[model samples]
Target: MSLNRRVFLGTTAAASAAMAAPMVMADGHGKPRVVVIGGGAGGATAARYIAKDSKGEIDVTLIEPTRTYYTCFFSNLYLGGFKDMNDLGHSYGGLAASGVNVVHDWAVGVDRDAKTVSLAGGGSLGYDKLILSPGIDFVDGSVAGWDITSQNAMPHAYKAGSQTELLKAQLKAMPEGGTFAMVAPPNPYRCPPGPYERVSMVAHYLKNNNPTAKIIVADPKPKFSKMALFQEGWGDHYDGMIDWIGEEFGGGSVSVDPGAMTLTIDGEETAVDVCNVIPAMKAGHIAEIAGVTDGNWAPVNAVDMSSKADADIYVLGDASQQGDMPKSGFSANSQAKVCANAVRGALTGSKVFPAKFSNTCWSLIDTNDGVKVGATYEATDEKIAKVDGFISQTGETAEVRKATYEESEGWYAGITSDMFGAKT
Candidate 1:
């Protein structure tokens, strides 16, 4: 996806909806109130899809702070200087247009016993079935000296929007020959391949604008998503511009001094001119407070994303533990469709047709040169498992690379269109 903001909101009608106040859905006759928390990739998609599929039987209420959402999927383009931040921001106007109630508020906590969600404001909202897709929250104590304030010193840029902009600005402001350090998180984090893809993008920028600059990855894991292909691409393409520190090479773990722009790994400290720290993550704050997360992520039944702890609640996105599925934007979008059908089934009190899902995540090695991984999945009684999956092979000819590039664009158009295309 391009980093041009225009793509997020395709029409002027969406912009006008952003200017309006919050829309509330009344539980007419006290129908099932499905309160969805967080309005990003998963929650927003679920709310819109469930509301449309249920045909007014389910009272859909979405709790989120922002009217506009910037996607993490394409924010790397912005960081790599290929696109602007505007290209990745999405608006909630489509949900409103589809008859889904979107409230601009932060969900502080969920009162599970009382069945109410406490908001930052003085109000409390109730729900019959709560769909929690609040995404990932940084795990404390994973990186020493890196708390909220320290975040500004070394932006993670994992969540996108302002943080992504900050990372880009810092990169632009760095000296021509400066080093860029990316501390990649351990496995089971949002966008498994994202950190590596990010370094590729950063290398692309440095190669063109600051050839003397270097991109270093401090990785916790020895292997990563499409590791072979990424490594080959980096070595053959960016080559010397990109350097990686695997688990055995003083790269796996991290300790950071944000003020110093320094990262310590394997008992040795390494200084960098710029840093992007992606810490460990769990379910978002709201999900944690609601007693949904077992440790870091919410445990859900694979068949429908229904929380194992709560009957009516369903978890999706990076927050939910879907066995064998990597947490990516495409995964969240696909999970939403599955959750939507489950919500409809529960509301109607009948068995629904089986659901199968597919996800494709495309990362740009450079502009016009992209790599992709895709999987088609089915749900068993216990967990979601991949039935088929493939990654783009390394050193494919230009023609094949071009075809995947176009395919990537086509997938983005189709997924976003199908996701946001639904009427409120």
Candidate 2:
């Protein structure tokens, strides 16, 4: 039987009004629901892509407590005043406008059997599939006498925003010829090249303001990402100001006294004006609570980033122990897209493409001095394996370095747009 209804015979304007969907499925069936935890590089991109690509066929809810998401990538530049805090801040308004349910609340727990997410704001959300990209949390006791309580005195500033500002203030207050100390994290940490770039930025700042001040780095790793490039830059630009002590020289065994403002490295005590301690990190707390993590990090199937423990949940970014990818924002965003495509295909019967991921980490040595390393990856049965890669050479012309910096700036804009769906 066919039913015909009279339509508007006269045309007034070509327009359509947006309609709201229920918090849960209301079509008398279990409509697919995707709950994304975290809203930075990984989570935001996953949510937006799932919602947009599904054409609102799937219910997407993004759980992030903060009203604005601050990026950690260019945070080093902020320390040098090359960019300000505002430049690192981004809003989720655009993602909301794209039909994603943006919830500014923490996901306290995930009941995998019940398929419900417990929220910190006194509510619960049900999901057919869950995406967890909760980023990183520091490991206590990794740095002796340094914990959340002492963050103010010896700021990590790894998460960006206020901590970055705090570290900058402490740097400004350093006395003439005073020392600034850094205890770099071990391997399998977020942003492999981040600490080195930060050192460069600090060197740039100190050279301009307090040229007499000195920097001491106690690194657990023997060699770091972009080592040759950074070493070359330090020797060329900040000669005689920066000293790096690697693991062979007792950099790995370090302890700090926040109260005394003293750092003990290789059994030698050195009083310092400021200390930045980046402790060992693991997946965020929620992953452990959800029982999806294997101790420190969540292991996932490389094919689609599905949890090895639960097929209904997927983990992305720094929280996931994915192979051949550093825990950087670029890596997270790349992984999110592949996961989003897989999740969308599973729920909506869409065609899932072959998973291919790539990442590039760029470091600013100085204003126009920049270097980068990146690789393309393919998901094998075992893990995501790197196919090929490239890195900046020890000596590059000023033109090439400037070009690399500009490329990084463009990438920052592009990635933020990719995550937040903003025209910015």
Candidate 3:
């Protein structure tokens, strides 16, 4: 509802310190080495926090293919033309300054028995503890005739980066009165409210640039997160520009015909000028190889985010299964803090106290109009339960809406600052 001043201060200090220090590498030898695979929301946050809290006691090595990460949280704003890549993009310079060894490489697999991680560069990294937060991988066969190749033609844009750019470009290129269709993923995936939020943002773009263009959503589930609120917003805000087909309308068989650029529903087919398909997903390959994911996601002890598969391993972000908690960036960021504390405690043999984790996910229905839901959580031996939380009530007041927007921006700054920044 409001800015978190305490966390914001911590984040700012870490970022500032990182900017000051340029070349920091003492963890390669000595100290417990924590190899964090992935540099997205989960890994970045964990690495920065661990390196900061451990005080050079734990060497954090973050393996990622890219040095920069564009926040999927605000990418919808980019789609709406309210923001640019720079507004969403973040770098790992702070982590480097905080003593995190940020490696630009893809993690291929893991030798759990030996506690080694193999990279794409034909080398292996040994770690005393491994934090796998590689995020999700699209399931190839979930949709018929849809794979990575097909996606190039009709982008998913789900994982951010180039694919997101492709989708934005396509939207801009489409002529007036053209069609924009989005295929929503089945339940239990990243960003539950993302598709609808995307719909609103895209519709906002079309409403001004291509007013006659239509936006259709093909959903696998009959219901969705904030369904009532989204429908209300679409109806009152965009009028007839947006349409959604739930399970009853789509027959629960979600597939895409990439060649035709068509979506099949029940026995009918509808063509679209641009298609965005979000496929089913699972833990990243490295996590799967390490036997961290139980089925689709990695299981962890919420108290510390340590992997159930191995004591020396931890998983966070969308790759890990956090029941009752939606798979979202906020969840991942919160989990990172818990994981960082645990890593510190484990290495120092200090008593690690459980903490109440918090998360708030804001979805931009339009630039000025948005919705947010947040919860504070606590973990017990049984499971994670919400301690306190609230969603922006439907038809929120002007002040509340504005505050939510400010909070969202603050969250972005705070999260990125925390992840890349060092501990103060």
Candidate 4:
């Protein structure tokens, strides 16, 4: 059955109660329990949709440590002063109101054999289905001379929130002609266009405040998402202020000294005021503890995002190694809906539609100058294969770029509302 808001709202309460009656008799349990770890775009959306759509047939528990979640999607805009931190921050009150049990605690471990999740607060939760969407965590020692301990001096700022604030503060306090260095990550990381957009935002900040400040990027990849668009914008907007060193130019061989405030590229060390080091990433620790991850990521069935390692445990967002789709907030949110439908169907015998997914990544280069890349996908036996795609063109009119930026604004507002309820 096609699930829509109107149909869901019009369904009689007696019908929903009848749908839940079978769950009680089948398992001798009051209701099938769904435990979701992570309260970001994926997990929050899944929990909300399952609870809202199931209509008391499912017990949805959301386990997230943070009360307020700051989105990493538009954080680059925050660095560029286009948005405020408050604009990116969302609370879990809406989820709780939507019939989800919002548990503000860390998920320390998972027992697949017993179908349970152990919390850091010394409690264990039993689940009929478990959804894992724990974004990303840094791969230890991925960058030489940099670790979690050095985060204060050289912030990664990849996770958003306080780290983003810290990096912005460092930029504001830079000397007039200070140098800003960035160590970009390798392929298959969260948001392919992220680090480059960050460069643009950083340049925008420095152009107004510290015009003479220099920005340098050392990237392992030969080319990045929206490479042409970003290169054009950098040249047109912030000429001679940004330097991008790719793999061909020894950009791949890099290291940092956070204490000394130095970055080494190709055996040459340069002193800098601030360093943004985005190391290689992996699935969050909880996914590994759950034994769902392959290497750095957890592989999932493209059809339902159920973990390949275990059927009952599903993975979503940056942590899942679903093919083709980039690890993006939009991708995660899209995947969550599909996963929610499948899980709800499996438990309550609801209609499950064929999986279809789509994603768009928008980046702001300068004021009213935004660009985006996006794609649509379908599930195959092997992967989530891309069906078609689109990207913002180079040399577009000023009006077009402005419209794109405005579209992103609308999307940000709509997505936040979708994840957290409208009242939020």
Model 1 spans > 4 angstroms off: 1-28, 349-351, 422-424
> Per-residue lDDT for 1-424 in model 4, tens only?
1122332133312111111111111233678999999999899889989998899999888889887899999999999999999989888767776677888889999999988888887868889999999999999998999999999999999998899999999999999999999999997899999999999999999999999999999999999999999999999999999999999998999999988999999999999999999999999999999999999999999999999999999999999999999999889999999999999999999999999999989999999999999999999999999999999999999998998988888777667667776524
Tens digits of per-residue lDDT for model 1, 1-424: 3322244335423322433236454443577888999887788888978887788877888888986788788788787777776666667777777767888889898888878888887678788789999988898877666876777889988887889888888888889889888888887899987888899888888888888998878887878898988888888778788878888887866778887788787788878888898888888888888898898899998888899999888999899987878898889888888888888788867467686877778888876788888889999888888999988887798777777766766665555545554222
Q: For model 3, which pairs clash?
A: none
- What is the per-residue lDDT of model 2 for residues 1-424, given as tens digits with 9 covering 90 to 100? 1111111011212112322222443232666899999998999999988998899799898888887788999999988779988899988777777878878888998999989999887868989889999999999899887998999999999988889999999999999888989999998899999999999999899999999999999999999999999999999999999999999999999999999999999899999999999999999889998898898999999989999999999999999987889999989999999999999999999999999998989999998998999999999998889999999887799998998988888788778777876532
- TM-score against native, each model: 0.93, 0.94, 0.94, 0.94
lDDT of 3 by residue, 232-318 (tens): 889877999998988887736766789988877776788889999888888888888888788888888777778887899998888
* Weakest ten-residue segment in model 1 by summed lDDT: 12-21
Candidate 1, residue 245: the lDDT equals: 88
RMSD of each: 3.5, 7.8, 2.7, 5.0
Kindly indicate the candidate among 1 and 4 with the higher lDDT: 4
Worst 10 residues of 4 by lDDT: 15-24
Model 3 lDDT-worst window of ten: 16-25
